[model samples]
Structure formats: C-alpha cells, structure tokens
Target: MTLTQDAAAAEAAAHPRRESVYRPGHPVDIRRTVGMLRRGPGDPTMVFDGAVIWRTVRTSRGAATLALRAVGDEIRASAWGAGADEALETVPALCGAHDDPSGFDPSHHPLIAEVARRSPGIRLARTNEVFDALACAILEQKVTGLEAFRAWRLLVTKFGHRAPGPTPRPMYAAPTASEWHRIPSWDWHRAGVQPPQSKTIVRTAARADSLARAFRAATTGDDRDRVLTSLPGIGVWTSAETRLRALGDPDAVSVGDYHLAHEVGHALTGHRTDDDGMLELLAPWAGHRQRVIRLIFASGVSEPRRGPRLTPADHRRH
Candidate 1:
C-alpha cells in the first residue's frame, strides 16, 4: 500500500495554512521543552534541528505538521494540514506556557534546588492529545528505550499518515485510534513489539474516543489515572506518563517504573531504593513530584549500573 502523503499534500494545497507567534515571558528553550514528546533520536513525529523543531501531530481536527522556532523572546510557529489551525492555537501550551511553578519550592532538597537554579528553562510540556500520548506510553511498557523507540519508528513509518510540510526529514503523524487498531498482528511483530504491548494498544484503541473524553473530563491527575489504569494493560507507570505528557500534570509520579525509583533514590540520598522508598523520598515534594524527578534526570545523576545493560528482547526472532 502507498503512503498517505498524497492525501495530506492535496489537503494542504486546498487550505490556507495557519501561523502564530507566541511570546513566552520566560526564556523558553523550545528543544528542551518539546523534546519530551520525542520518543527517540530518530522519532518520526519530532525533529530537533538546531534551534528549530518540526513535529507532526494527530490532532482532534486532523493530522498536522508544526514548525516551531525560538526567535528573541518569541516563539514563531507555523502549521500545515487540516489540523494546522488547532495546532497553531495550542502552541503556547505546548511550549509550557501553562506550566506554573509558583508553588514549586526547590528549597526542600539541596540537589533539587541546585538543579532548578541551573535549569531555569525546564518546563513540563502538555500535548492535550490523549490517545497519542497513551499509545506512545503503552509502547514503552516493560521495554528498553531502544526497543520501544525502534517499534515506534517502524510502526509510524509504515502505518501513520505522511506529515504535511517541508519537514527537515520525512516524518509522519501517529496513526489515529482506529488506524492503530487496524494495524495487523504481523506488522506489530515485525516492528519488534511484544504481543502483550501490541494487544494492549489494540484494545485501548478500540475505545479511544470514550477514554479520551473521560481523561479530558477528569479534574485531577488521580482521576485521570483511575480512568487510565482501569484498562487491563495500563498501570501506574503508563497512567502517570500519559498524564504528564497529555495533561502536563505536575505531580504525576510514575510509581512502577523499573529504574525511576532507583534513580530518584540515588539522586536524592546517594543510594538505591524501592518503589515504596522512592514514594516516601518524593513525598516531601508531593504536588511537584514529577517536576522534582525531571530535575533529577536533568541533573545527570543516575545509579551506576551494577551489571551490563539489559539486552533488548527481539520478539521478531521468537
């Protein structure tokens, strides 16, 4: 089957593209902010080239290609495709304009305080697109970053709609929920996605519409987590990830992450800890736990690996 580049090209030709200039009061590092959305160095949905970023989104309106660049204190944004207008409208939030750090006092911990002082440009970005964030999170479940990123690259390149713009490189928007559901089992295998992860994606995609609405309507991060984890395959880690990415929930701490607890513990107390210990350690930050965790990651402090890196499982071989 041919790629959907033709359809997006035709649609772009028929519509007037949208553009906006967003002036975030603070020094906004566009790459550091939106780079959270990128799955890997070779992610098909996001490209960071120098000071500019090109991203393709499967928006509620439709597929869109957004180009964002930081100029002086203003962020210049341009969007192409049916969803261009919507994408342009959300540029400010996407650049972390809505992330308020007023209540986040870094004085609770010396390490956190130092990191916060040094990394003033770090802000939690919100996509406001639930399914895309959820799907990406699900793909990462129980897998190494290498495996997850490769699966994302292969799947999006093969099944996703071609991005509608002059991207730095060929890019594509993540497939819609229905399209994700329709991706064949063999295709998932070929992409190195395990059966469990692939099944979870398909099952979630089947109810993406209602789930998206539920997640959007939920007022608190806990409520959203309840709605997300109610699904059979989704758990605390996936829910927290989705909330962080989709809603920019400041307090969403990934409880079940394999290395997060150890990393947080090492960064905070100079040793390793379990998930429970991590929770207790992060409890001081409570409402801003994820922000603290982000600081820890940005601080370049991680637990030394006791052994060799875990070899990524190649499910295709099985």
Candidate 2:
C-alpha cells in the first residue's frame, strides 16, 4: 500500500466505533485528526497512548467537556452540554486542522518528506485555548516536567471549575485568565510554584486573551515570535516552543532549549554540540528546521544518557 493509504487504513483501524453528536456545519473526522497525533510510544506526554484524551472547551458562559479515544476502526468522540456543537467545531481547529498537512504538499521538500516518513502522525496540536497553554508553559519554566505537572494538577483541581461532560473521569478546566490573576502568591507557592515562575504567569495572564489572538493572526515564524515575545517573561525559546504547537510553524526552531542542542548534535553528528553547532547543522533546512528536528526525534534515536534524570523540586517544601 502507498504511505497515504497505510496512514488512512491505520487511522480507520484505530477508531472503529465512531459516535459523535456534534452538528457543526461541516463533517469533521475526529478519528483522522486524532490519528495524526497518535505516536506509537516514548512521547513525553503520551498524548497518543490514550492518556491525556480528556480536554475542556471554554466559552463565555462556561465550559464543555470532550473525550477522545481510539476504538477499533474509528475514533470515539463524546460531548456534553449546550456547547457540545461549538466544542466539536472548535475542537478540530484547536487540534490543529489549520496547520495540518492535508493542506500542504509534502512532496515539495525533502525535509518534509523525511518528517512525514519518520513521524506520520505528527500534527500541530493547536490548543486554541491560549490561556491554558500559557499557564502550562509558565508552570514549565526552568523546572522539571514532573514539577510542572504536579503544580498544574494541583492548581486545576483546587481552583479550576469541573468540566461539563458525560465522561467517567473528572476533568478540571484550566483556570481562565481572570482566575489566574486572582490566584495569590501563597496559593501558587502552595501549588509548588517558585516566585519567578508565578510572577511570569501572573504577568502573562493579564494579556493571555490578547496574546492568543495575536498568535492566531500570525502567519510566519517571525510574526508569531514577535507577538509572543511582546509579552513579559516570554522569550525566543518560549515563543518558538509555543509556536511549534500553537501555529504548527514548520521552521520554528527552539534556539534556547536546555536539551535540544545536545539531542540535535547527537542525532546529526557523533558527539554532542552546542547551540551554534546544532544551528549550523540544521542551516541547510532553514525554512524547515523544526520539521527536521521533529524527524530526528521521531526517528527514535535516543542520546546516550550519562547521568540521572533531573529531579523535580518542591518549592513549597524548600
């Protein structure tokens, strides 16, 4: 079978019992959209492994709940509440239909072809929920993911509203911009956030709505980067990292990452390289540098570890 055929078959086989009540103007294949993000294993978030399928969609009145799962031959989608139709329509867009490869011809570029081969399921998971992404990013600043996840879980459970849906599991809505501003320093500390990260989150929350709109307007890497960096505490690395998922930017290389330099170096060359070396190696694919990086990562080439994993610190205990 051709690669495209294989992808379609895999998607169909992945979700068999398709069920959705979303009456949006157009027919949206949730199974196909979810399939694009279903990497086999080893993904940090395990977004494809059936975890993290519960997401909430917020509206002016409140929020709706949606659950996604891969059932045989079709994706099972369930929604609840008056906003179900709106959530259904908006969910696909949030999941990155806008930047999906269905609109792009991968045959035009060698790098894109390589990426498509290595990571057939990689899609831009555009969470149009700007405040949620911003809040999560803030929790991740200079901290281990475990630490961030812990803080996120605590904050959501304590301050966030319960998601409206029929799902068995309780999914907490990420705090809105107004709620984020109301969270006191003590509450953040109790949630294991450091002063610096908390400050950044508070400052950014003030303009979370506006920044999200700016990102939606941005079409190029430079445009997105410029708008993101305009916000306090957002830098090149943060902007690039966010744009990778938010805008599905093909060339948004993360220049200030803590481990990407080493990972890129190891994948491209025999030894570790600095940020400059990584950039030099990737210069050939300037327009598609991010795509190249995703391919190298999806190629499943792990760098040999010389030390233990970074331990997450509990600032509250400290």
Candidate 3:
C-alpha cells in the first residue's frame, strides 16, 4: 500500500519495456508532475536521487509512466502506459529532453550562466495534466496559498481517488473535471472556498472536455492563448500559468503575481520593482523570460526585507 509498492504494481500491470540512457548513482531528479496523486502529510513519495530515475507523466494521450536509472554515463528509461512506447519516445520533447546544455547557452548571459551552473537541479516543472493545473489555478484565484492549499486538500480528499503506486508519502489524486463539478456549494464553504472562486470552478468544470480538446489542438501561440482565455475566470495570468505547466512553455511570464515583481527586482537590481520594472528588466531575455526568472530564483539572491510577514486571514472565523 506504499507509493513505491503501488507504483510497482502499476508498472507490472502496464508491462513496461526498459531502456538505459542514464548512469545509476549519477545526479538525477524528476520534477514531480503537478497534481499527480500523493498521500497526505503523513505519507511520502519515493523518488530516485543521484540519477534521474522514475517519473510519472500524464499527457494528452494518457498517463505515461517512466522509470529511469543510471547505467555508466548514460541514463536508461523504462516506460509503460496507454501510449508507453510513443510516450517514451516523446519523453525528451515532453521533458525538454535534449542535451541539457543545448538551448540554454549560459555564455550569452553571465547572470543566467552563473545561476544555471550553480543550480543545475532547477529543471522546469511539468504537469502534462492540463485539467489538474487549471483546476488548481482556479482554486488559487484571489486567495492566499494557505486558503487554496486547504481547499485543495479538502476537495481532493473528498473526491479524488488514491494515486496508484508505492509512493513513500501520502498524496491525493487531483479531482477529475466531472468530480469537480459534482462538489456541492456547502462542501466548497466547508473547504474554505469563497462563492466567487467556487463558481469559477463549477463553470470551468462544465466546459472541461471542450477546453481539454482545445488545449490539445492549440499549436500556435495566439491560438493557444485565445482558446485558454475563452473560459470564464481564465484570464491572461491564469491562462499563462496553466499553459506554462501544460505545454512546458519556457517564456510564460507570471504577470499578476504579488511577489514576482519584488523577487525579480531584488534579484536584478537590489530593489523591488513594479510589473513594469520587472518586464523591463526581463526584456533582454524575452524568449526565455521564465527560464531567466527560474535562474534568478535558483541563484537564491533574494533576501527577506526587515518587515513583518504577511499575516494569514481566516475567512471562516470572520
């Protein structure tokens, strides 16, 4: 009943074919697929360290489970699922799977290069699961992260199925679109969701199937943005965030974040910047804005200002 055991069972059921491409004991890390099921606070998920081995991917085609272990200098991959072989073949594309240093030429930008060199573990976080990402984004609308996380935990526990695998920690499966729609208003209140956010979730859920199709069909930048923004409550920022994870976009700038401008400013110029300042600072790397931001984040240059932390407000107690 452990995550690893559950994963082993799922792998066995799927009958994965193995191939080696990475060396065992080498540094390997797979970004957890956002919204994939995991046990609660008490449980843990088992992941490979040293060498990048074993990743669970949910894609447009279906769930694509992969296991990678190190062998000499090469990394081997064992993948299985509805489209196992194709998914495995597409792993590199899905995972930015080319040589690590190919597109990210650090030499062009001294700051980026230094950051990348220093923190090589900051690979892009991919969720391959569009609906889950969208749902989570919806939950986060106009609320503190604590509120969102609390609601997410409650909703998932109430409606999400247990993730299949032997994960070391407990995690909840993100609720499916239909399941999200089925959540009663009272439950939303209990989960600490305000009426507005709750309505957005319901609205999105009703059109989930259509949105999923549109997301898959969207190939051009304009087309993708248009399709995502067509939904209620899915504006520029929300759509951008969802597309960033769902499509693994490298340049999606989070424009409306409360902290990003300050973080970017602190990292770039030792002062907090507004959205305009943040955009101006990032203009040099337009195509790779998010990547640069990631590097700045990895660099760990931002320090806390001498001020009180944002106080948490409990609407339930209000």
TM-score of 1: 0.93
Question: TM-score of every model?
Answer: 0.93, 0.76, 0.75
Model 1 per-residue lDDT at 259: 91
Give the per-residue lDDT of model 1 (tens digit) for 1-318.
245767656776876678899988897777778888899999999999887899997777777899999899899999988789888988988999889887898999999999899998888899888998999999999899999999999999999988777788999998988999999999999999888999999999999999999999998888998999999999989999999999888899988898999999999999999999999999888788889988998899888889998998777999
Query: Model 2, range 130-206, lDDT digits (tens) per residue?
Result: 66666676677788767777788778767776665444555656678879888988999998899888888888888
User: Candidate 3's residue-wise lDDT over 1-318, tens digit each?
Assistant: 999678767766875454435332323234432212222232112234345434444444454456555454444666655545654664444344422333556555576778777656454545466787787777777777767777777887677654333333343345678889999988888888888778988988888888878986887555767887887677767776777766666677878887889998887778999988988988876667777787786676885876986665666654
Instruction: Tell me the spans in candidate 3 whose CA falls farther than 4 Å from its real position.
Output: 1-94, 98-109, 120-122, 220-222
User: Which segments of candidate 1 are over 4 A away from where they belong?
Assistant: 1-17
Instruction: Give the Cα lDDT of each candidate.
Output: 0.89, 0.65, 0.64
Evaluate model 1: give its lDDT.
0.89
Clash number for each model: 0, 9, 49
How many angstroms is residue 131 displaced in model 3 relative to the true structure, after the best TM-score fit?
A: 1.3
Clashing residue pairs in candidate 2 are 12-73, 15-73, 15-74, 15-75, 16-71, 16-72, 16-73, 16-74, 36-121
Which numbered prediction scores highest in TM-score against the true structure?
1
Candidates sorted on TM-score, descending: 1, 2, 3
TM-score of candidate 3 to 2 decimals: 0.75
Candidate order (lDDT): 1, 2, 3
